[model samples]
Target: MQANSLDDLAAGLARNRIAGLVADLRLDGLHSKAEAAAVQTAALDAYADDFAGYVLVGTSELSRRGLGLSSPIFAPLADRALFGDGWRIHLPQGMIGAQCELAFTLGRAYPERGESIDRHSAADAILACQPAIGLLGRRVRPGTESELAAIADFALHVATVCGPLVEPADKDSLDRAVMTARIDGKTVVTAKAGTILGHPLEALVWLAQKLARHNRQLNAGDVVTIGSCAPILQVLPGQHLTVEFEMIGTASCWFD
Candidate 1:
C-alpha cells in the first residue's frame, strides 16, 4: 500500500480505538456523554469523506445533534442530483423515510475554508434554491448512541435527493412561498417556505459558523440543505410524492 494510505489506515484504527474506548466508558453524566461524543466526531473527521473537497450538510432543527445537520456527512453518501423529475426518486424499503427541505446550490465559493459568515453574506453566496429531500435512516444501537456519536455517524444520514432549481428570491418574498407534499396520491403534509428555522438562509448561516469552527467552508457546486418545513413523513413502497415550492417550482420523488 502507498505510504499515505497506510498512514490513514493506521490513523483510522487508532481513532476508532479511542472513540470505542470512550463509547464504552460510563456515560450517564452529561459531561461524560458529551466528551465521548466529541471523541466520536473527531474520529469521524479523521476517517469519513476523506476524499471529497467538501461534504454537504443540513441546517435544520430536525437534526438530533441540534446542529441542524445530519451526523454522517463528508462520506460517500448516496445522494443523487437531478431536476424535479419524480421518476428518478427511490427510497429504501422498510422504515426509511423522507424530510422535505430547502437546499441551495452555491455559485460563489467562500474566501477561506474555515471562516464564519453571517446570514446576509451566506445568502449572497447562494446561486439557486432547489427542492430537496433529506433521506433518513438509523443503524446505531439505541443504548450505545449519543448525540455527539450520532453527529459523528453522519447524523444518521442516508442520502439527499434534489429536484430542479429555482431562481433566488428576496428573503421576504421567498418567505411567502407555499410548499406541500402528497404521498400515494394523497396530500399528507403541508408547510411554508418560512418553516425552515424561519428562513432557509438562516440554516446556511448556521452551517457556515459550524464549518468555520472545524476549519471547513461551503464552496461552489456544493449542496446545502436546510431543515424540513414540517414533520418528516414515512413513505411506503410504491408511493409517489411531489413537493411544490410554490412560485418557485415543483420537485418530485418516490419510494420503491
Candidate 2:
C-alpha cells in the first residue's frame, strides 16, 4: 500500500473508533499482513497514551479454521477500555460479542527485541492470571471486510472486563482449566484453556516472537489476553454476562 493510502486507512479506522460507528472500509489496497500491522499501529497511535497491551484473537484451532486464518492476529488493548469485574459497561451502538479468556499480567519485560522466547520464559514473566471477558465489535460489518481489514480495525476488540488476579501454584494446571460462560444466567459455552493454541503459554510465546520480529516486546505491567476459551457469545443491551475459569476466578459485566 502507498504511504498516503496507508495513512488514509489508518485515519478512517481511528475516526470510526472514536465515534463508535461502523464503517465499510475500502481494503482492496491492503495486500500484506505487514501492511495490515502497519495500519493497526498507525491507527492505534490515536490512543497511544492509553495503550494497555494486546489481545490475541483466533488463537484456537477451531477459531482459526472457522475464520480461515493460518495463524492468530492481535490488536492493542486500551487501558481506558479495561474494567474490573462486575462493572456496568456501556454498549457501543452496534452488534457486539463476548469471549471468556485467561489474561496474564506481566511482572517483567520479555527479553530484548529480537531475543528468543519460549513457553518457559513466557511463563516466568507472568505475574498472575485473571479471568477475563473480551467484548468484541467491529468497525466494519460482517462479511463485508477481509481479515486484514479486521486486523487494521483493532481485531474487533471493544472492551475488556477482568476478574481478580490469582497467582497459581501450578501453572500447567491452567492448560486443563475449564471455562464456562453464562449469559443472562444461562450457560452458553464451555471449553478448556488449552484450546487456545494447545496451551495459553504457547499463545504468549507466539505473541513475544511476533512482536520481536516487529521490533517490539512485551513490557512490564502489560496485560495480554491470550484468546477465548469458549465460543464468542452475542452481547445485547441489558444483558449480564459472567465467565468462570476453574484456575482463575469469575468475571462478570453488564451491558447497558
Candidate 3:
C-alpha cells in the first residue's frame, strides 16, 4: 500500500480490502475544504462493507457554502496504540505531538444501526470513561502550512494512551476537572475540561452524529474521544509525556 504519491492510493483502494487508510493524502488543487472532505469520503465509501470505521476524523466547520460538514478522514483500528502507563511508543517518523482528551468506551450497543442518539442517550450507553492522550504525527511531509492539509493526512492519529477506567456516575464532574501535561519532569501544557464543545459527553454526542451522516453507527465497544483543551505539545525522543486529570487519574506514554 506504499506509493510515491496520492495517486497510488487508488491502487490501494482498488484492492477494496482496506479496512480504511491511515491516509495522509497530499494532493494539490483541493482549494475548498468541502472538496477535501469529498476525497476523504470517497476513500471511506470505497470499502463500504469492509469498513472498520474511521478513527480520529471529526470537525464541525461552516463551509463557504454555509454548510456544516464532517471532514471524513480517518485511520483504521490497526493505527490505534492502546497502552498502559510507562509504555514506550515509537514515533517512527521522529515527529509527534500530544493532546489530552476525555475518552470513552461503550459497554453496549448504541444508536443501533438505523437509530439516532442524543447527549443523554449517548451517555447512557457508555461503559466507562478515562483520561486519554492522543498522539499525532504529520505525513504531508514536514512543511504543510494548513491544519486542514495536515488533517487530510490520515497519519494524524498515531496512538491513544488511556488511563484506568471509571464508572460514569463515579467519575468526577468533567466541568471541574483540570488537566496538565509534563514531559521529562517539565510541565508543558495545562487545561480545564468541559470545554470540548462544553463537556466530555457532548463531544461523544457530536461524534455519534458525525458518524451517522456517513450511515455509520456507534457500535458497542467503540472508543470515542474529544478535542483537547491544551495546545498540541511536541514530544521528542526519550521524553516522557504525561496527561493528568484531577479526581480521575492520568495516562502517560514515553517516546522513542
Candidate 4:
C-alpha cells in the first residue's frame, strides 16, 4: 500500500519523474487498485506542477484495477508532451486519425473552483490558434469488452500539431462552422466544430474544469486541442494532409 495519495503521484508525473516509476511498473506487469490510485495521484500532482491536470482516466485502467492485477501498464499520457511544449511520438499501427477542430491558446490560468469564467472570458485569453490533433492509438489486439489487458500499449501519442494564431470569437454557432481535411488534394473528412462537444467552446470548458480537478489549470499560452471533429483517417507513407477550420485557421502535416 502506498502511503502517498493520487495527488502526490500526479505531482511527481507532472515533474517528469514518474516516467522512471511508470517504466518500472510496466516491466513488472503489476496492477493493483493501490497502484492505480498512486499513479492517478502522481498524475494529479504532476498536473499541479504544470497547473494543467488530467481528470479522466482511460477506461482500460479502471477495468484492469477492478480485476485485481498488480502494476497494470498506463496509457502514454498526452499531458507529458503538452507540458514540455514539445515532444513527438510515432503513430502506432491501427492508429490513424485526421481530425479538424479549433485549437485554444489560453489567456490566463484557468481557475478550478473560483468564479467560473464564461466563454467570452475565454475568448480574450487567446494567445495563438492553430488546428490541433489528439493522436490516439488503441491497445494492441483489443480484448472482448472486459478481457482487456493494459493501457500502457496504447500510450503511443503520435503528435500534437497546432498553428500560429487565429481570431477568437464567442462562437455560439460553432456547429454551423464547417471544417475539412484534405489528403493529397483529395477531401478526406469534413465536419463542424460542434462535433467536438456540441460546441467547440464546450471543449474549452471541459478542459478547464477537468484540469481543475487535478489541481491544474490552463494558463495563458497553453494550447488546448478541444477534441476531434471528424473520424480517424488512416494514412500512408508520404501522405500530405491539410486541415482547415472555420474561424480558427489551418495546419498541415506529412506522414512518413
Candidate 5:
C-alpha cells in the first residue's frame, strides 16, 4: 500500500480503537509485517507524547500458535493505560481478557542501536521486577481479520496494572518462580516464570534486539511487561482479578 493509504488505514484503526468500535475488514489491506508495523507506528504517533514503553506479545509458543503468528509482535504502551495495583478499571465495551505477567523497570538507558545485548546485559539494566496484569481487547472481530491486521490494531493491548516492585535475586531463582492468577478469588491459571521464552529476562533481551533493529532503544524508567506467564482469563465487569508471583509480589484490579 502507498504511504498515504497506510496512514489513512492507521487513522481509521486509531479512531475505532478510541471509540471502542470494531474496525471494518478494510484492515486486510495491510499486506506485510513491515506494512503492519508502519501502520502501527503511524497510529501510535498521534499519541507519542503519552507513550510510556512497549509490550512484547506472543512471546510464548502457545500464544504464537494460538494467534497463528510465526513470531512475536510488539505494541507501544500508552502512559494513560498504565495503572498501579488495586486500580479499578472502568469496563469498556467489547470482549476483554487479562494475562498475568512479570514487568521489568529499566534502571538505565539501553545501549544505542548496533550494540549487542545478551541476557546478562539485559539483566544488569533492570531496576526491579513486579507482578502485572495485561488487559487485552481486539478492535477487529475474531476470524474477520488477518494477523497483520491485528498487528495494525495495536497488538490487542488495552491496559496494564503493575504491583509493588521487588528486586530480583539470581536468574535461576527467577526461572523457578511460579505465577498464579485468580478471578473472584478462585484460581484460574498457574505457570512458571521460565514459560516466558525460557526466562523473563530473555524477553527483555528480545525486546532490546528487536528495538535495535528499528533504531529504537529502551529508555531509563521505562517499564516493559514480558509475555504472559499464565493462561489469559476472560474478565467481566464487577469482577476482581489478582495475580501473584511466587518470588515477586502480587497485583490486583477490579473491572467496574
Candidate 6:
C-alpha cells in the first residue's frame, strides 16, 4: 500500500495533474516526511520514465509542491536535501509570503545522462543566474528542513519569476545592495540580496549539487530561486506589487 501510494503520487507529478490535487491535500491535512519523499521520488521516476521533454520542469515539480508540505517532512530531509535559496509555503485563505533570491540555470548537461546528478558537478556547472521571487501561501505550515519533502510535494511553489542575470558577485559585497518591494507604490519589504544563505550565489551553487543526489541537474534556461533575503510579507487581491534592485533592476505583478 505504501509503495503503491508513493507510485501514484509520483505518477501524478509526472502528469502535472497533481498541482491542484496537492493544493487540495495540503489544505485538508498534512503527510509524513517519508510519505512525502516517496511521493517526490515517484514523481521524479515517472518524470524520467515518461516525460523526457520537460525533464527540468518535471524534476523541479517536487520542489514546487514541497513548499506546502507540513513540518514533519522538513525535519528529516534537511540534512539530505539540497535546498534552493528561495521557497514559500502558502497558508490557507490567501495570506502570502514572498521569498526573493538569486537562482541558477545550467548551460551544460550536468551529472550526465541516464544517471542522477552528483553533488560535486551539480555545484560546479552554474552557467547563468537570475533574480527571482517565490510566492508562499502564508496559511500553510510545511514544517522545517523538508526541502526534499517539499520538492517531492512540489515545494508548494505557486509561481516563480526571474529578472535579468548578472555576473556572479562576491558574497560579502552582494549584501550591501538594496532590494525593495512596493505594493501599490507602498513599501512592503526591503533588504539586501544576501538575506539568503548569506550569499545568494552560494545558495544557487549549493542547490545544484544538492539536487544531483536525486538524479536532477540544473538545465540551461532552468529558473532556480536561491533563497529569500527579505522577510515574507502580506499581500492581497487587487493589489499591484513591484520590486527593484540597485543593480539587477525591477519586476512587478498584480494579485487577483
What TM value does model 6 have? 0.61
| Model 3 error, position 63 (Å) | 19
Off by over 4 Å in 4: 1-96, 138-141, 144-156
Candidate 5 achieves a global lDDT of 0.81
- 100: Cα error in model 2, Å: 0.9
Tens digits of per-residue lDDT, candidate 4, 1-256, equal 3344434434533333323222212212225534544554444444434423222112222222433323222232344444221223344444535444456666666753464756655555555556755454332233311212222222223345555566655456555777788888899878776655556666666656655666766766566665566665666657776777777666766666
Best by lDDT: 2
Question: How many steric overlaps are in each model, in order?
Answer: 10, 0, 2, 25, 0, 43
lDDT by residue (tens digit), candidate 3, 1-256: 1223333443333222233223344444446555445544444345343432334433212111111124423444332355656678776552456767777788777677555577767777888877877776543444453545534444255567778887756433675688888888788877777655566666666767766777766667776666565666778888888888887788888888
Task: Report RMSD (Å) for each prediction in the order shown.
Answer: 7.1, 1.8, 6.4, 7.7, 1.8, 8.4
Q: Kindly list the per-residue Cα lDDT of model 5 for residues 50-87, writing each as its tens digit.
A: 87788877777766665565777788798888899999
Deviation from native of the Cα of residue 211 in model 5, angstroms? 1.1
Q: What is the clash count of model 4?
A: 25
lDDT of 1 by residue, 38-146 (tens): 5434444554533222223333345334333333233223233223456654453223367677777777785354434866687778888878776654333335344
lDDT of each: 0.55, 0.82, 0.58, 0.48, 0.81, 0.48
User: Lowest lDDT 10-mer window, candidate 2?
Assistant: 62-71
Query: What ordering of candidates by lDDT runs from best to worst?
Result: 2, 5, 3, 1, 4, 6
| Predicted candidate 2 versus true structure: per-residue lDDT over 165-243, tens digit per residue | 9997788668899888888999988899999988889989999888887777889999999878666778888999999
List candidate 2 stretches off by more than 4 Å: 65-68, 94-96, 112-116
